[model samples]
Target: MVDFFYSNQLRYRISRHLLYWLSFNLFLAFIWGSTGESYQIHLTVQALLWPARIFVVYGTLYVLIPKFFLKRNLFVFGISYIIWLLLVTIFVQRTVWQYSRSFFFPDWKNYDMFNVTEIMGNVFDLNLAAVFPLVFVFVKFYNAEQKKYLTLEREQYKSELNQLRNQIHPHFLFNTLNNLYSLILKKSDEAEDALIRLSGLMRYMLYEANVPKVPLSKEIEYLRNYIDLEKLRLNASNTIHFTSSMNKDQEIAPFILMPFVENAFKHGISNDKVSTIEISIIANKDLLTMTVYNTKKINANQDNGEKTGVGLVNVQKRLELLYKDNYEMIRNETESHYKMELTLNLI
Candidate 1:
C-alpha cells in the first residue's frame, strides 16, 4: 500500500488531491456559514471535519477499492462501504456536535434531532461526502492502466523484431558454411581466409545484430564483410559492385536491409553464368535510400520451385512492424535483372 501511493510521480498527484479536497471543504464551510456566523466558527468546523472526511475518503479509495471493488466482490464492497460510512457519519456527528454546541448554540437541546430516524434522514448528504473519492480513484486507475498497455505494446514490438533478426543469422550462416565446405572439398588455400572472414561475420551477429538499430557506417561495414564471405564461392569472372553516399551518422534497423542483399547473391548466380550484383546507398537530410540490383541467371530449379523465400517474407514483416508508415520499399523485376529500392527516415 505504501509502495503504491508513494511511487514518486504518483505521490505528487496524491498530495495534490489531498490539498484540493481540504481546500474545497474549507470553501464549502465558508459558504454554509456566510449569513451571520463568525469566520472563527467556519475555520473550526473545517478543521474538525477535515480529518473525518479524510478517514472516509481514504478508507473507501485505498482500502475498499483495491481490496474488494477491484477484486470483483461487488456485494462485499457495497456492504463494507455502507457499514463503514454509517460508523463514520455517527462518530462525526457525536464528536463534532459535542464540540460545536458550546460556541455556536449553547442553548440547544441534544434531543432535538439526535435520534436515529432524524440522523438517517440525512443519508443522501452523508453518502455523497463519503463516496466523493470515487472520481479521483477512477481517474488514477485509468491512467495507470493506460501506462501499462503502452509498455506492453513497446515490448511486443521489440520481441517481434528480435525474432526477425534471429532468423537472418542462421540463414546467413548456412550459406556461408556451404561456401567454406566447397573450398575444403577442392583443397584450396582460400579456405583459410574464408574461415577467418566467417569468424568476423559470426562475431558481429553475436554482438550487434540483436540490437534494434545500428549506425549506417557499421551496417555498410557488415554488408562489405558479407560480400567478402560470398566471394569465397564465386568464380573470377563474377562482378560485384558496392557504393555508398557517405552518411555516417544515420542509423537503421539491424538486419533490415541484409535479406535483399542476400537474395541478390543467392538467386542471382549459377555455376556457369556471368553473375553481377550492383548495390548503392545514399542518405540526404533525414531520408536514407538504397538500391540493390542483381543480374538474374537461368535457374535449374525453376521448373519445380517456389519463387519467394522466407528471408524476403521475414524482412517484409519486420519493415511493416518497425517502420509502419514511415518507410517505403519497391521490387522491380524484368527478364534479365531484379532490383529492390527502399527509402526510410534516418532518425
Candidate 2:
C-alpha cells in the first residue's frame, strides 16, 4: 500500500485501470449474449463464470502476449492461446450444462446440447471475444515504453550538460591563476586588481553559470570583466578591443562565448612584437552573432599540447545538445591570424 504511493507505481496502477475494467465488462457482455431468456438465471451464470473469464482474458493478455507472442514464438503462442480458450469454454459449458440439466432438462437424457461438437462450434466466437481487447493492451504498453524512453533521454542529456559545464571551470581557473602568478612574480601593481577581477569571475561562474541559461547582458558583462583582466597583462605595444550591442533582456547559455575570447588571448600575445586582438558580439531580436580574431605571434605555435581549448570543445558539444542544427560556426585560420565566427538562433 505504501509503495503504491510512489509516482511510477501510481502511474502504472492508473494506466491498468482501463484495461482491467474494460476487459472484465466486455467479457461479461460476450457471455450475456449466448444465454437463454431468463434474466435471473443469466445473472447467476455471469457471477459464477466470471472467474473463468478473468483467467482466460488476463492469461491471454499478460501470459501469452509477453511470454510467447512478443518473444517471437508465434507458433507456440497461437496453440497455447487456443488451448486456453478451449479449456475455459469446456469448463463453463460443463458447469452450465450440469445446472440446466438438474433444473430445466431433468430426465432429458443424452441431450445434444452438452456434446463436444457443440462446444467445438463456439471456439471461434469465444476466441474472437477474448482477442478483441488485445490490441488496446499492446498499444498501451507501447505508449508507456515510449514515455519511459523519452524520460531517460532527457535525464541523460542533463547529466552530460552538467559534466561539460563542470569541465569549463577548471580550465578557466588554470588560466587565471597562471596570470595572477605572473603578475605577482613581476611585482606588477595590477596584481591586486587582477585578483579582484578573478574574484568577480569566480563569483559569476559559481552562482550564475550553475543555471542552464543566464541573461545575455550578464554574460557580456562577465566577458568584459575577463577582457579587462587580460588587458592588464598587456603593455603599451599590445592592443585588445571588445565591442558588443545587445538588449539586456535576452538570455543565453552561460560561458558559451568565453572560450573564443580566451583562445584569442592565449595564442595572440607576445613581448617581441606588437599584437592585436579583436572581439565583437551583436544580438538583435532572436539572432546572436560573435566574431573573434587575434594576430598570432611569431613562433606562437608552441605545441601547447592543449590544441583544442577544453572550453571550446565543451561549448561545441553543448551547442549540439542545446541547439542541434539551429546554430552555425565558421573558422578561418591563416599563417598570420586566426578568426572564429559563431551565429546562433536564440529562442
Candidate 3:
C-alpha cells in the first residue's frame, strides 16, 4: 500500500489533486461567504461543509463515474454530479432540521422545495461551476506530464538496445580480423581477397545495420562473404559444402545470422585432416531455415583462446528479444559430426 501511494507517479498526482481541491474550495468559500444572508453559512459550518461537499460529489464523480464511462463525456459526468448534489442536498437539509427546528422554521421542511430542477440548477450553478474548470486544469497538466515521462522511458530503452548491438558487432569484427591476420602471417595470397570481402561486410554493417531491418538477401550476402573469408585460411585438402535458397524480397534484422555462421566455422571445421563443413539456408514466404554441420577437429584450439565468447551468447539474447517464442534452434552431436538447425518466422 505504501509503495503504491509513494510511487513517483502516484505521489505527483496526489500532490496536484490536493492542491487543486484546496485552492478551489478556498476560492468558492470566499465567494459563498460574500453572497446574500439567505446563502450565508457559518465559518465553522462552511469549513466542514465545503470539504464534505467536494469529497462526496466531485470525489464520487471523478472516481466512480470515470470508471464505467469515458473521462471526456462531460454530459454524463455532469448528470452524475447533479444526482450526487441532489442526494447531498436532501441529506444536508434533513440533518439541519433534525438538529435544530428553527433552522428553516417559518415554512419548515417545505421551505426550499427539493426537486430535480432545483438540484440540477444548484449543481451547475454552485458545485460544478466552481470545480469543473479547476479539475480540467489539473487533468490537462497531469496527462501532459505522464506523456513526457513515457516518451523519456522509450528513448532510454532504445539507446540501451542500440549500445548493446554496437558492442556485439565490434566484438564479432575483432574475431574475424584476427582470423585474417593468421592468413597474412602464412603468406597466403587470399589476404587481399579477404580484405575485399571484409570491406563489403563492413559497408553492410556501417550502412544497412543502422536501420532496424534489412532485406534477407543482404544478410545472406553477408553470411556468404564471411564463409568465403574463412575458406581462404583452410588448406586445399579441406571440404566445405554450402547451399542456400532464399526469397529475393523478404527482410529481417541486420547482423542477426552472422554469429550462428561464425559458431559453425569455429566449432565444425577441422585443420588436421580431410575435414568438411556443410551449410544450407532455405527461405520461403514467412519461414527461414538454416543448417550448419562440421567435423570437430582433433586437438582443436579455439580462437581468442576461450571456450566461448560474445558471439553465441549475444545471438541468444537477440533472439529472445526479437523473436520471443517465434523461433526454434536445435543442436545435435555425434562421434564424427556436429550440427545446428534453426527455423525463424520472417513475417
Residue 260 of model 2, lDDT score: 88
The local distance difference test score of each candidate is 0.78, 0.80, 0.70
Best model number under lDDT? 2
Best by TM-score: 2
Error of 2 at 113 (Å): 13
Error of 2 at 131 (Å): 3.7
Model 3 residue-pair collision total:
0
User: Model 1: per-residue lDDT, tens digit, 26-126?
Assistant: 76776767767677765665567667677777788779998997786989999998888788778877776666777676766654446777567444445
lDDT of 3 at 230: 82
What residue runs in model 2 are displaced by over 4 Å at the alpha carbon? 1-53, 62-124, 299-307
| Global lDDT of model 1 | 0.78
Comparison by lDDT, 1 against 3, better one: 1
TM per candidate? 0.71, 0.73, 0.60
Clashing pairs in 3: none
Name the better of 1 and 2 by TM-score: 2
